[model samples]
Target: MKGNSLSQVYYRPIEAAIRWAGLLRFQHEIVAAIIDSRHLAVTLNCPRCDELRLYIDRIYDAIYHGELPYGQNGITIDDKSLWDSPDLTIRHVDLKRWMLNHYSGQRPAFLFSRGERIAHPVITLEAGNALLVEREALKSQLEQCRSQLRALQEQRKKHDQAPPACTLCPLSDRAEATYLHIIGAMLTLMLGRSPSGTPYSSFNSQEAIASALIAHHGHLMGITERTLQAKFAQARRKLQSAVS
Candidate 1:
């Protein structure tokens, strides 16, 4: 009934010794139960909640860009929009009772001997569905982007002879140069060669090699740390595919 307190939900202490199940059991079970039953999915199923969540997302965008997203002039959240519809509010009350009765205590040995606690039942069904709803929202947004791109291409076709207002710079030459440099650096590192063209005492580790390559030739190779990271990721994928 109170404002959704996010600090406890978001900022749990991270211990290196803990595994995924240990940390995420609370949130995980909440989602699992919601998806397993339709009645428990009221928050996600509610139209008012969808509107409120979209409004909140715009509020976030306003914070970052100093304007509402999607070129909207003005946006606001009202009291009715903040909470659920009457039916859903009653459903929420019932849902909390159900969770408390069914999933509130320690699991028996038959269920899970690993001792996953369901103590602080602060999370609601709507909150549990937040990630799934957000993912769906992203898919919708991406579809909108693809549609806009196709529209732009169609518009460009109508102006066949005219050049676009912004000409896309050709990056093939620069990309080829960067690719060659990376290959050369990787070959040298693999062969245990130092910058002075002498053999090093021992081969460098993959992480060390990546770091050294980025530090020595990142600017010259027209690469940033992020670009080098992508290259490294591609290389790893290639190696994984070959092994598989």
Candidate 2:
């Protein structure tokens, strides 16, 4: 019906904002919902059991990856041998009507929400590859963080102090290290080179100290800047005492 417009559905600005920011791309199908090519929506399929079973996951994968993810289930089109089956026609239909008739059985009068749909450029294969690369890089950094945490733990053990009981303390230190690693990896991904002269050792040192304090205290040391400053001050005094 004249290409269902989201603006026609009427939503408050705040509701629209929350829907846009909070919705995951993978929850809906990506479709060009406008007459002229300005807006897009995550289309929901109607409730025919076969359509529901076949197209639901297809839509989700398309929204998530910016392209249709291929699979080879008996019901799916990717089963090349079943390409000629009459049951596998890919039809693009009116999203609003589909939701009304199929999802709600025409019960909910308003099928389209103004802010529920968002327009994004389709992700190219290169972009998907780049994401995979970043994911691998994050995993590698996580491993490095684990190794660094182990080394720090060993170092702390060598000193004349009781061993820590709080496991989260070491995990928090590892998370901090991983956070830096993620930042570095992002920089490398965007700039096509590693960031120059960032002090990896010093970065780990800060995390090590933070972890040590948390291990001793059994909680996040503090939230306020002043409180953190006090903790650091205390740590410095303790270090001096140990040396003396």
Candidate 3:
């Protein structure tokens, strides 16, 4: 999204927002319903939206850093990969139909009692910021701690005669190993079919592969697709560092 002196909001396609919802802590349907881009873009760009994105980013950090959080149910990622599967797509259609039937998107909301119009819903920025500041501060402190932990782990590995890579990194578990396998499977699929009618793997796009795996193995542990992706990326970086 592009931001200017007067405005920061832009009408990204609803799909873009939905995909973001899949990655972040928010519900896709609620994000789809409330994020009135036309309304937001024309008006003063919300400071609230900025806070929202930052909030999501903090949650993203927690998930990718292998931290488990409790409480804050409203804001937790809950470790579910919300990929754009067929079931989710249908819900999108259903929500659109219900919204269209209930109200007109082209027009503003009418308050018959007060006779006021809210073309786009407006929220007080200060109140939301007040609620978020304390949590945000705590999250910042937590991120600092994680960075220190990683640094200490690396330093310890340098002097020691290597107990194990997993001990040094402290970044992998059985579940994460499964996620890594999913990443490898995605790569195999990207390689495509072999010559002699021997079936190999299918589907491309790492995000899609992770999502599909989550769908099939919902019983299996998972976090955000982006988290799985982050894990895959971390593995690659470590491998590259070793090779170089």
The TM-score measured for candidate 3 stands at 0.21
Q: What lDDT is reached at residue 21 by model 1?
A: 20
For model 3, what is the C-alpha lDDT against the true structure? 0.39
Off by over 4 Å in 1: 1-111, 115-124, 161-244
Candidates ranked by TM-score, best first? 2, 3, 1
Looking at model 2, how many pairs of residues clash?
0
Output the better candidate (1/2) by TM-score. Answer: 2
Clashes of 3: 0
Q: Any runs in candidate 3 off by more than 4 Å, and if so which?
A: 1-200, 242-244
Q: Tens digits of per-residue lDDT for model 3 on 70-140?
A: 11212323343422111111122322333344432322221111232253443356755864674565456
- What lDDT score is found at residue 192 in candidate 3? 41
* Alpha-carbon RMSD, candidate 3: 26.5
lDDT of 1: 0.37
**What are the clash counts of all predictions, listed in order?**
0, 0, 0
* Top-lDDT structure, candidate number: 3
Q: Write the per-residue lDDT of candidate 2 for residues 136-180, one digit (tens) a residue.
A: 665576567557646644544553253454433444655555444
